[model samples]
Target chain A: MASIVWLAPAVTPATEAGDDPLLPPFGAELIVDFDLALSPYSEGSDDQQEVFRAFALGLHAGRRWHRWGVGLAVEGTLWRTLDGRGEDDWFGALHTGLEGSVLSAGGRIRTRVGGGLALLLEGTALDSAGGAGFYVDLRPAGLRWALDDAVVGFDPLTLFMTLPDAGGIPLVDVQYRLCIYAEFGR
Target chain B: MSARTYPLLLAALGLMTLPAAAHGYSLQTAVSDSCHERITVSSLDVLLDLVDDVSGFEVPDDPLLRQLLGRLQFPGTEDASLQVRFVMFSIIIGVRSPDTDGHSTFNLAALRRLHADPAPRGQYAHALRGPGDDGIAGDLAAVDGTIAAILDEVQTGASLSAGGVIADKPAYLDHYGVVDVPVALFAWHVGRALHALQDAHAHMIWDAEVEHIVGVLNYIDAVEGRLEDADGLAHSDALDDCHRDDVAPLVEAATRRTRALTLAIVEAARTRDGAALRAGLAPCVDDATDRDACGWIVYNPPCRAAIRAGDTDAVEAVCCDDANDFCGSPYAAIARQEAVGPYLGCATAPAGQSGGWAWGLGLLGLAWLGRRRRFAAPTALALLALARPAVAAEADEAADAADAPPRLSVVVEGHGSALDDRVDAAILSPAFGYGVRAGWQTGRWRFGLHVDRDYWVSVEYGARVDGGVLDVAAFAEGLFFDDYVRVAFALGTSTLMFDTELHSTGNTGVFSEIRPLGLRFPLGERLWLVLDPFTTTVVMPAIELDDRLPSLRKVQHRTIVGIEGGFL
Candidate 1:
């Protein structure tokens, strides 16, 4: 007497969430992210800080499980960069990817993981401090000689847990982290 | 007989004065109380002797039997002697924290509930209730007369883990019965906890905690008259020799085991060693109320509030102290409030804040006008028929009725590498890898573990430029979402130590995943997106890649930071 249909959620009879074509197409989310990384490279100064900033914009195709759903948006960040010698330096890399989640249950909980080519923009500002730099002087060299790989962790996509406008810096140290996570994909 | 040889000690201690023939009810109370502490291998041996004469049961030999039986040869099982042991175990698993006024109040509440509501309450009792409630029913599946309810809370199955269903399993099955479910589930968890030990990381449970587990299990065997009765299990005839010569000894051994470990637990707890507590009580910390018993019940109003605010100092103040306080035991819900909070940050938002799309859809259906309207009744009925999807989706979210899943899972992932070196002494072609995942699922939540393995392809120390291998990897992640807000936590293993002159050590520096929040409108045919903005954290692992293995060329570690987009 009771039935469970998977496609029944986002569609009237067949369409899924995020698959909708008409509803105001997903808006591009311009993410201006800044990250301060401490290389676990013991051979080098463990305290060596690696600061990076990037802007990417991309939207995803819409999805619908049982009812009417929304599509994903693709966004690319502006000019991504890093901090060298305690000063903000230009990031000679390009980043592009996708993000979205399920529209069921009154809210949306996202699970996002994406990657793209990161090549040096060729010309960038010089590091005034003499601490650490990329492409020309200190760390590594060129776009191919630059840092490349997919870096990932959880990103709060909804307002309930999002940080309030604060960015570029954090409120605490490494000890602030508690959870243990893993990443893998060849 | 083992019992006859130990009568002097039992009698000397006044424990043998009771009529040994009818000690069922009495021994049950005694052993149950005694089981609350740290049990050791040596103490458990003697516990078997105490229960040797009981007639109805026999010792069981499970997959973990030999390991458990090997532990029961010690002495001591008095209630007072084992109290400390039980409390310590309670604390590690988030059950009986010192915060509940120095008592395993949650467990105590369970005892009260068991005593208070002995009658069956149907499946409703298994629903995911809050603290102090025994969501798992007492009647676990019977696999040869042994207690297996412990598996009811497992959340480690494959589908369960991907779906984040392990955390909710135990509470869901509070009404039904799953014989091997609990054991299989806990086994995976304990294995994962143990793996953490090898990684030199801190978690809910550790390897050192083993000394205490064997102790409690030993006590259980001793009190239960474990195995002796098995060989002699010839209730078929009166004087079967297997009953006398074979089974009796096993029974005695099991009884003694229970007594010894109970005493050991008590001793360890008195010393207040963090490791000892971890080993002694991590098992019972399976539920929210169990969190109370484990003494993880954090009552510091300000500390708790600060934890919510993501205050670092407050987290340190409350969690750093590993003594016999409310949060001293790693078992309390409060203990994980910060560091692991996001993963455990469950969502309980109300439905239809803006009213379900059902209303809008409903209005659209009413606007129809046709001659089929002549049979308006049938049209209305058909519209309602189409309403099943909306209603079912809402109902599934609410879980209006009963019954949930009993999940079990096992996983193993590994990676190997190669490297090379040149005249520049620059390393080329290097690699490293490690992966271990396991979980248990029960009801709507899933509890799981993700272990990380590091594989450095090679390390090339060059004169001109210095850069090595790096693997952008994720170590662990916990997520909960199904028509609700989901908290996803990830641990990134970003190692750039093996930086060699070789090809490239994959270091996806940007570790990020999307956590959904707010009401979501269905995205497309098979997807959805949270309607609001969310937050996330990024991390770079502290891996030292200076050491190189014998068989490789250069440091080679290439991997993704984490996965995002679509259902995984």
Candidate 2:
């Protein structure tokens, strides 16, 4: 009885402190993106070329890139071109080299034009397919036009259309994309 | 043709005489009105079949007879309609259709020049004339046993496997031959048969089979969840085919043998204790792959006890099959992970693709026939429906959607092809369009729309010839049924159109679709699987030139029965 009474104080409400607000919805969410497309690809050649009709899906779990995060993307090609005789095959590649996007005028200045590394592996099952590639990407912040989500129309929402459009701003030729991330973290 | 052959000729005529509309057969009137040319051509087919039948009976050797009979034999489950056509095609073409086109000609001169003095063609006559044994009871028993064994295997392994293979354990480490085949082959067949059974009305009678599989899912899922909760284990290596195929999973859990991710169950089994084995599952739940595994397992002693007591039902209900695990919502994230990174292109190839073994042989035989003769005349001339009929077929034109305007869509689908281990450049092609789509969103209703289109402007299909070749095109039409996806059957037609040149044959090869009934699964908002069992009936315009060689500009009917899916 005595020990129970002695321990009661620690468990009592009087010792309680105020709340801690450390848990969620406030941190900057780091973001990474990858391209996941399989195809009888069109609008591209038999070589290692990136076809635009294809789009990207979230892949390889989201990785935060606000810190020192860099990405290398590689895409391979498989092709079997058919003429009267039979099949002639080739490959292609599209990649980039740079750091995140920048804040520039000229529509985010579409900074960091790309040059990707490539190789051609051949044989058959009669077609070209997987290839190896590596590249770096960078985009900067800039102001531009965008549609406001709330308005659901061309409300001319303000956008940070930087070279590497990461915040709901539109950019071109993304190594898939790394735009606005929807997360609980900041 | 002689009077003796007239009976068969009449029977053939009768079979073809079904009201074309009942089978949804149409006269394809849009092609030039080449009716007379068609009659002459069909009569020729009948005459050829009769001659071939007679020629077969002329053979005296038993061995040759048996071999031929085997070729013509129709095992149950195979489409008999196609079997009958094979006989007809073999008779008319002498070789196979494809062969006739490329290598062999079916003319008398060619037949006379052939090496064999007497082809054992009569073998089919003997087989077809033979009586069938209706041992329904015996067949039922066998089927029952096969189905039971299959279910038992699946039931035993469903707990042990993830997508037919044991989740991440190197296979070759254990007894290779014994373990692998059972898990892989047995489970695969069970799953396959389950699908087949569902397709063939088993859901109405044997719902238990489905229930059993779904029922057993609890324990396995429980274990999986626990394992996941634990800091993920290190045993995530893809097992070889052998290990993945059989009861190694049962053996692993039952024995607790671990050169890989063996459970701690067998340790208990050694003590003559199922309790230990039951407890062994705790590792999966409580002490799974990583830290999370420990959390789920460390606290669930009662659940472990329930499993140990051999009370699968209790363990299932208590641990899994609850709102958290059973409805498949909790693991959507994990499932997505598995779905995403499927090692690019090195996965095992799908069966019956491009021209697998049986198809290869079938095609080879067909190509042989194509090289041989003028089998095309009948298909080329079957155009009589465009004109006056001696017997008016009633079913035709009655079900016409002419008054019903269908909402049409033209889809340009692009998909990647695999060549061995590599993926190829995406190929984009526009599929022909035609369908009547109707959508009702809650209270909002949209007008019904009917749509249709040929693959290309021309109605001709897959025409091949000397110097001039027409491309093959795809077309589709939709038919809708009410409510419930399964209850609602979507009716549709696919047409492949192309053109070819034949001087003597009369350029009447129009609307010859080389495709058959197919099913597909949608992958994305617009993507879907397209699986079709292909069968084609060739139609053409017939211009009477001469009932001879050049007039036989050979028609080759091509059919591909296959399953192609993934991202439409």
Candidate 3:
């Protein structure tokens, strides 16, 4: 008698289950960042300090649980003097951090805050030129818009502080990123 | 509010707010101009002094001076325009003059060699002892060879002026329709010869103590990823900046060598005696060997007498100890190395003719791609057939249209850089380009192949060289708003070619283009006009002068307009 009675399984829609159609739980991003560094301890005349500019291209991967997310980012940055002097410096870094959506609008727009710590390795001819350092990348605010499987993000002002070896004073830089993420596994 | 327009707007706004600055050296006219000024001033002094010493008058009107000047076709000192023209002609033929980045003129082609030789012979007249080197003898021989080449060119020009049958003129002369081709040609060769001799003084270290040129700095090494191996005392800009306090001595030395070489060249031209040219270049040679040898024997006349008496022990005792002591200093060691074998000034052999051949093959491939239009129809039909199935279901829904949505289209585009004010005006301008794209469209997606050519002109040192960029890419586009708006992204490789006399050489790099806001307007049933407001192409490992000049990388942005015609 118990085996004869068959029951149907319950079905639930993704929206009803509090899942966002745009802000995917697992996704990857392609990022382009422009960095401007203020090296207070650089070699230059009294009136001027050697300004450094870097162009970075990167990949980011993360998994999200509701409003909180954890991610790992890897990027290669090409560094050069703003005045076009000397040779170019290249560096690669791996960043791991946590990000959370502070505000969301209709599951289409989200404002995020994130901070990451990175270990940077120099990739240049001169050994120890820009010594291997640890970087603290803090995004106090960022805005992202979702479009189906893609998300466009802009971090207007990101702060980077590098703590070099030998306990030297930290090197500070300001950066902005234009990111496009092709989301999957929503 | 379409997905296509949203990302496009965001990309455009982001690009607009990005900061940019000029990223390379200016045309480097300062270095070339300074070279010309030094040569002119020094030649005048040497000629005036020679004439005065011979005729007891402070004038350059002596018969010898006049004959030499007339034969060399030396321009009047006060005629600035003529002098500039003379220098320009010289630079055109003497150095590989068409580098857009200005390294050729700045380094005076010192990084390049006459041939792919492993020896320490640079385009600079300065030669160091190396494999296949004969020391000062080799240096003198190189100088003689350059002089011979110059005289040969002058003779050819003279013959041409005299209505002699010459089959071909120099390629560089095509742009300059000079009235006196003979004088222009002579000045050209002289300018070429003078550049090397002058560079010897600038590039080589002067030993004031021994009054001899000791060592030559290798600029090619300094800038070419071997900075650690390079001499710290000298760099690419060390002697180039004539006003630098440390460079004053080098300039003075260059002036002295310039005077010696000019006098010798003039004397040789007057007498047609090649020996006189060699003797003149001897003064410019590294005399460290003789100077070092004399240091031991001169003070100890007994050592000289012992050598005359064939007393080997006495000679070795006084001279060998002194030689060892002298070699203790790094400069003396370099000087000693110069006496025995090759010193460090020579750059390694260049990439050689293989690069030129590869460039030629690429050009031919591009030409084949351009000429084989007959294959376009079949290729388009094949692509359309492959794409038809994917859009077949959508096509069944729209039976009213004459043609299916999955049709092949060919687009021709004209574009120009939008970075005129954003980059260094001297280094780059808003150059124009043209391209073609062929693709198959299905539903809201299109995929295609694109070929583009952008022509750029580099003007420097009063000479112009044409350069170009050839881009070939594969792109994927998304159509939105009933196919009125489009956003396309492409990844491609670009080749930047410089049209120089030796060979067309260039750098090749990978690039990606994002056409953010492209509007397609219907002109007819099967034709449309495409306008892109912002297209950004970022080339990585950027295009620059050859590996010799590695620091210059440029990123270009452009706006594109095109016309597309559907087929099949």
Please tell me which predicted candidate would have the highest TM-score against the true structure. Answer: 3
Model 1: residues with Cα > 4 Å off, grouped in runs: A1-52, A55-87, A91-186, B1-402, B413-434, B440-449, B458-479, B482-568
| lDDT (Cα, tens digit) per residue for candidate 2, span A117-172 | 32223322311222222222222211112123210100000111111110000011
In the order shown, what is each candidate's alpha-carbon RMSD?
30.3, 33.9, 21.2
Looking at model 1 chain B, report the run of 10 residues with the lowest lDDT sum. Answer: B211-220
**What TM-score, over all chains together, does every model reach?**
0.21, 0.18, 0.36
Poorest stretch of ten by lDDT in candidate 3 chain B: B171-180
Instruction: Please give, for residues B326-444, the per-residue lDDT of candidate 2 as tens digits.
Output: 23432222222211111111221233231133234435645765595433322212231121111112212211221232233223322211111111211111122222223322211
Interface RMSD score of each model: 27.7, 31.4, 22.3
Which TM-score value belongs to model 3? 0.36
Candidate 1 A-chain TM-score: 0.28
Task: Give chain B TM-scores in order.
Answer: 0.17, 0.18, 0.39
Better of 2 and 3 by lDDT: 3
Tens-digit lDDT string for candidate 1 (B430-465)? 233444434454443334555444543211111122
Error of 3 at B451 (Å): 32
User: Quality of candidate 3's docking, in CAPRI categories?
Assistant: incorrect
Q: What value does the lDDT take at residue A101 in candidate 3?
A: 38
Candidate closest to the true structure, highest DockQ = 1
